[model samples]
Target: MNSLSAFHRPLGSTGLQVSPLGLGTVKLGRNQGVKYPNGFELPDDRQASALLDLARDLGINLLDTAPAYGISEQRLGPLLRGQRQHWVICTKVGEEFENGHSAFDFSARHTRFSVERSLQRLETDYLDLVLVHSNGDDQTVLDDQVYPTLAQLKREGLIRAYGFSGKTVEGGIRALEQGDCAMVTYNLNEQAERPVLDFALSHNKGILIKKALASGHLCLHGEDPVAKGLELVFAHPAVGSAIIGTINPHHLEQNVATAIEVLGR
Candidate 1:
């Protein structure tokens, strides 16, 4: 098996390429006191920004963040200001939060407002991709509000592509069948979404795997679980990238090195 660093795949048919291992910034912002087995500390804004710079330096180009992740967009946006062209800045809407609690708000107006807010926060004119951040089982949100708003954004040139983030396999398949989304992020370790991954592969939709290590659960019981789990996902013909979060540059370097070794790049 190849090391984790060897994986770089195209994100859908959008012509945007990304490392198979991308940086997920949710934990970088505020983990909300969530504990990881590695005892990893969540980095503050300065530290997170530095980590992002280092990740980019290491050849990780895709950075995923969400408005729901308290101040993540607010923090990541500024750090990414001048390097917009060098990386894929992907953010999400439909989820809102205050005081660390989150709620779904997929209304068209909210979606529009969210994009504007993200642009303002990130200090960028356009986002590479805007995902409908659904918590699974929100078909009404996808059918009625999410797609329509994203369509408008694409028409207006505010976003390059749009897709959905599913917490369940059924929801992922539903998004793929709808035929408007360019990519989808599905949970790989759960294995509940393999059929969805297969469907996405058949349709040529971009597939990004999330929780590939089951939020570090897999890592706790084994050595280099992130490396192993990512290898499995990258081997899957459908997967385009895997988004993993870590505040440690050492860990991030390990991820990139593993990819380079595994993918033979």
Candidate 2:
């Protein structure tokens, strides 16, 4: 019940196993244009490296990063050098952030280029997972060439699996039908995506829950809201992993402990 690795589960039928909690690296790479309840500073290389070390020791293997997360992908490359096999990296394409602004490119060319760039930045020959970073218009983004390009990459051995980080129920279902997984926002404050989780459960597809703590906003309420929120997230059978974006080592440890307790029960 204490070791997170012991609770690792299959990510649908992707043949890849991930811990109950994945580390989300947005705060490690970017601090601007975020929706957290409070402001924070980016961690230095030493601090970030230590955080990764702690995460590994706690038995978390899934690391979620993206091009839109400022220089997160780039920083993770150097920080995670020589330890690539110890982790399951899940990155995204389609969305890119620059000058504090965001842009979307779901075209076939960009999708292909993004995968290669992510490979270069992560210092890996192949990526464990690649998701299409939807621009809130989930259905429209899926209708583009992004999904098909990811499929091609998967077949080419560039990526082990591909999916969509979408915002809609229909999009999540469509993603699972066409790919291996879907990342959706499922937290205490948001249950609008429950249908997506239901579909994933019925279809036996992978589902990654984003904003499980409501970007830390849920903590503003009653006691131990983080624990309550995590309880709600892990209560679902479809959740392959819940991505928690905590840069604080103490917070990370507490989150993992809470998850172990929840999963144990």
Candidate 3:
């Protein structure tokens, strides 16, 4: 097993590489209505900067945030600051949450607008990856103007890669056939998304595992369900990375160490 400081892998054929454990930032911005077992106070700018510094110290290079995740993109902009080149930023389009409700727009216009807005919010000229934040209608969103718009953005050098964080296997496959990555949910309690992971691996498409700890629910009553969950997730040859969003530095370090132990990186 290798330490988190030694884990870096290619992201399919996008010409970009990332660490085996990408840091997710949902908890950083949104706290109005979250599903985490415990309540949390949103971190101030200083704390967020420290967290980024810690993640960098731990050798984490990939960051997963989305426009829909409250002000995560905006917050990261200033925090990342001069060190922006050190991280692979993976953000999303198609959905927005405000006043405790989510509204989705998969239109070509909205997709392009969203990417431009994300770039502005992140204070970056280009994005490493941009995924379609599906509204559970994965196929429909893919079939709509969103995917094509992203493809165009890629051609124009606005985004390096495009992907789908979908809700179904059918949609996951569709996303892969297009030669982009898919963020699927796979954990001890829910394995229904295994087929999606398998497809991505067999076809050489990138696979980023979301909810690897079942969105923080897996540790509710377990001796250590997270270790068990990540052990299973990184064992597969096709597993590219696992996005774990932990606000606590200790928890983040432990998760990375556990992955290092499991994958023998």
Candidate 4:
């Protein structure tokens, strides 16, 4: 298959096809130092806008963001107004940011409000995908509020698909068991999530690999360690896509080239 075709994969049973390499927008919104290394301050709006344009031009169709990412959806939505239809905009609910810290809020009412607010910020009538952002605890939240709320949104057509962006392997596994979720994002460097990856693959769940470079530590010593690590993850039969955050368009293009080279190998 060609690079674009290789990049495209089924997002669970949602029937949505997205690129294998996605753009993570937290850095673009000026929320750094959370999950990434050397996370220093983010770039200004003009630079972020240029990066988004570059990503689209390079065929990146999935853009992952979260409300906790501090003004990401608000800024990205307006910049992507003309090209919104060309990409899959993925955002999360259940995690809120205050004072630059993230907190979980999975109450049914809060979940509903989060989705609605995300829609408003994104300037879209419906979300391409909505994930319940979990911080490794509160499995009950998924059972009690998240699942039902997501189902309701899907039924109402306010969301095309829903899933979990979890911090733990067990939480991800549980989310997959619901069988209604369209995709799951998990830390790939930690083997703890391997079982969840297997389950998702077996069931055809959309699998997006996060932290594939282990928060930039994989290549800390240089020599393209991150590229090698990503090669392994992409070769895995289960992983559908990997989200890499970078401020420079040249770095993005280099990573894409590396992925293409590794896939060919």
Which candidate should be chosen as best, given TM-score against the real structure?
2
Candidate 1 error regions (>4 Å): 1-7, 33-42, 179-189, 219-223
Ranking, lDDT, top scorer first: 2, 3, 4, 1
Q: Model 2, stretches more than 4 Å misplaced?
A: 220-222
Candidate 3 deviant stretches above 4 angstroms: 1-3, 219-223
Q: Estimate, for each residue in 1-265, the C-alpha lDDT of model 1 and write its tens digit.
A: 2233234567767577877787888776666744466555567768877888788778788888989877888887777767888888888998887786878888889899999999999889999888888867656666667777887998899998788887666677787776434334443356767887888878877777777767777733545676667667777787878888788788788777776766663
TM-score per candidate, in order? 0.89, 0.97, 0.96, 0.91
Q: TM-score for model 4?
A: 0.91
Best model per lDDT: 2
lDDT of prediction 1: 0.75
Give the whole-model CA lDDT for all candidates, comma-separated: 0.75, 0.92, 0.87, 0.77
Per-residue alpha-carbon lDDT of candidate 3 for residues 182-210, written as tens digits (9 for 90 to 100): 88888898888789888877788888999
Task: Give lDDT tens digits, candidate 2, residues 47-86.
Answer: 9999999999999999999999999999999999899989
Q: Which lDDT value does model 2 have at 121?
A: 94
The alpha-carbon lDDT assigned to residue 158 of candidate 1 equals: 98
Ranking by TM-score: 2, 3, 4, 1
Candidate 2 C-alpha error for residue 91, in Å: 0.3
